[model samples]
Target: MRTAKFWMGTLLAGALALGYGCGSDANKDPTPQDVPQQQVPDAGADAGVVLTLTDAQIARVLQVANEGEVMLGQYAAPLATDQAVIDFNNQMVTEHTAVKQRLDALLAAEGITPEDSPLSLQLQAEVQQLMDVLQGPNAPAAGAALDLALLSAQLNAHARTAFIGDSLLTPQATNTALQQELASERQAVQTHINEASDLQSVIVLPPVEP
Candidate 1:
């Protein structure tokens, strides 16, 4: 049962030590040595192909997911006036929190700890930018204005989450349990994206006073 502080400290230390964001290697394809074998589960034609991931990749995925959960939860805390927005925010908070907890437990069980990667660092920067926008003087004063900002941010965040869960993490996952988790993560992110889009459509911004 490693504490959250421990996990954060370890991940940040690793990120700094490795200089994760220093190079452009983040976009490089996984080398032959780095690639994990795929396992085809028997479920007929509808069964999707399952891929394998290295332990390092798994750690990276967990780190990104954990940081995302923390950032979204923080951003959602201050914008709870509208019941609809509040409900959506609550759902995201609950889902992402559970994701982080589950990933943490998996890492602990495997005697592994998460380390930071370029993607995680990128997500951190994005979260900070969004926070600054929300908290700055220019931030909207509640109502539809606030809801639009929040939903827009959530849309972008969940889009990235979906991409990472599907393109970056899912294909590289080796463990059956982890693969299942990633699948669920992808679905959840897509759901968030749809919800955010719907909210954005219905929000009626107040008109400017001439």
Candidate 2:
């Protein structure tokens, strides 16, 4: 549980740092930029749907990520037995809920309604798959198996999120505010990865029965 405490504290510190001196000169309405026609993950399934996303589309995808984390955290809470894992789940729920609220406020202030894209839809599907794995009839029991599963899922999810933030969202951001926000988000996701990795180190899963 100490690691859980440290993870929450780190996230809080990062959020405060972001809020302290980063908002004075940001553009309220960031202009949308044209990204080159590139293939996103699962692009082949969509065929001709180029992932040249607008700021609104990026926001929508970000919202999906945030919401997915919140859902995963909530679902894991009752099923997790390890104190550290439980703490992690609670903190994720808290931070992601707060982050989503802030994002919603930002979008409202800018009079921007996030627009969905093929990327966002694909992400939604991926998140749902994770949820199914946890919630389905064959879900792992509430112990080391569950803990390992949750940690592994978070590791993969956050890594992908950080990659998207760095490779796609930040570069496509035309608004200084959105860029700054995305930078902060990327940092937070990295922190999550670190914490998840640490938790994974301490968990010992049972050997599979052949």
Candidate 3:
């Protein structure tokens, strides 16, 4: 009975973790026949979306999001026409660069880069796996869709600023800075999703290039 109870508990923990990882709303990306997303227009121009990513958090955010964008573009090349790919490519570049710019401004104001170590490497490895699948033969459509959804949730949960910016407005020694930083990151994640959705629209041209 003890052994059985242990297994049951472990199973329950795993299930909860999986649910959280996939997102509370499994239906968030509903598309026809499980394709995950409806046809989105080719993202027209860089001006189409504006996200506020500060320079303080730019490097890490870039490291993660860029890898994700690259994986998405390469792995799912067949999903969108060439023009749509180009549009997505442009959007990714624009929004990510904007993140860099904002971070740069913040850095000049406050002289620090947040601590990042093995975490960045871990994320890079995951991106490379997705890339390999894309660049590899026999890559299935199902795998690509699953990877995109997983990465979307991961990025959404990550921090936006190197340090919370709210404390900065207070005194230099106050603890509230961390909270402000977290809030800023949360906001940045929302902006990223909106821009990504916008870019998804324009990729529906006939015979989307792989």
List ranges where model 1 is wrong by over 4 Å: 1-54, 204-210
Q: Which portions of model 2 show Cα errors greater than 4 Å?
A: 1-50, 205-210
Q: Tens-digit lDDT track for model 1 on 1-210?
A: 211111322222332222212223321222222111112123444234333446555666666755665576567656746677778877777777887878778777776656655445555666676666667677666766676666555655665566556555777767777777677677776666666655555554323569
Where model 3 places Cα greater than 4 Å from the true spot, the runs are: 1-79, 82-86, 140-182, 194-210
For 18-124, candidate 3 gives per-residue lDDT tens digits of 32333333424434332221122233453233223333333453346445554554444444334444454455556555655665555455665643333343345
Candidates 1 and 3 compared by lDDT, better number: 1
Q: What TM-score would every model get versus the actual structure?
A: 0.65, 0.73, 0.43
Clashing pairs in 1: 52-172, 52-173, 53-172, 53-173, 53-174
lDDT of 1: 0.56
Native-to-model Cα distance after best TM-score fit, residue 195 in candidate 2, in Å: 0.4
For model 1, give the 10-residue run with minimal summed lDDT: 32-41
Best by lDDT: 2
Tens digits of per-residue lDDT for model 2, 121-180: 766776777776666666565667678777655655666577666656788877667777
Position 197, candidate 1: lDDT: 59
lDDT of each: 0.56, 0.65, 0.38
